[model samples]
Target: MEYGQPQASTGGSVVRAILSLLPDWVEWTVLSLIAAWLVSLGAVQVWRRIQYCRAVRAGRPIHAAAQYGQGRGADCLGSYAPPRRPDADGD
Candidate 1:
């Protein structure tokens, strides 16, 4: 019975006791890992789209973006390979 000071509660606060089992730092670490995974997933999708568009414009096979000339042949406008001519021998 102290003046101006609150007496300790006789009844147990069960909810608080349970929450103290795990530290706050562990929760924050898990949240950060999940956020990073989602960001990387979005970035990978964007990169694939850019490669697909380049392949279509260059007239290279759509399925293989890497086959398109990695050299200077491609520009803003496409530089498709010249159409093949029929061989003179007709082989």
Candidate 2:
């Protein structure tokens, strides 16, 4: 009736015996490969999310205050200034 001892059942005894015979290196390698794959997937998902945010922010309208046709001359009407560069210095 020890807490850590295997139960007296056929399947449990088989599982316990197999676990005792497994090599430590085999277990470690399997666990490491699984962990590496999960980390790589997470990095790819984060990169995709960043790209999506950039695309959405790029497509947003520039200004609410300025008239659609304000700056350009009579023939050149209805165009706003080009989208500002995110990385620009205030020049």
lDDT of every predicted structure (CA atoms): 0.65, 0.70
Candidate 2: stretches off by over 4 Å: 1-21, 60-91
Model 1: lDDT of residue 44: 97
Supply the global lDDT for candidate 2. 0.70
lDDT of 1 by residue, 1-91 (tens): 6799876554545544544665778656766888999999999999999988998999978754344344333333455655435662222
Model 2, 1-91: lDDT tens digits are: 7999766899878866775677988767766998999999999999978877877799954443456544323324435556547895433
Top candidate when judged by TM-score against the true structure: 1
Model 1 residue 58 distance off true place after TM-score fit, in angstroms = 1.2
Q: Best candidate, lDDT-wise?
A: 2
The parts of candidate 1 lying over 4 Å away from their true place are: 1-21, 65-91
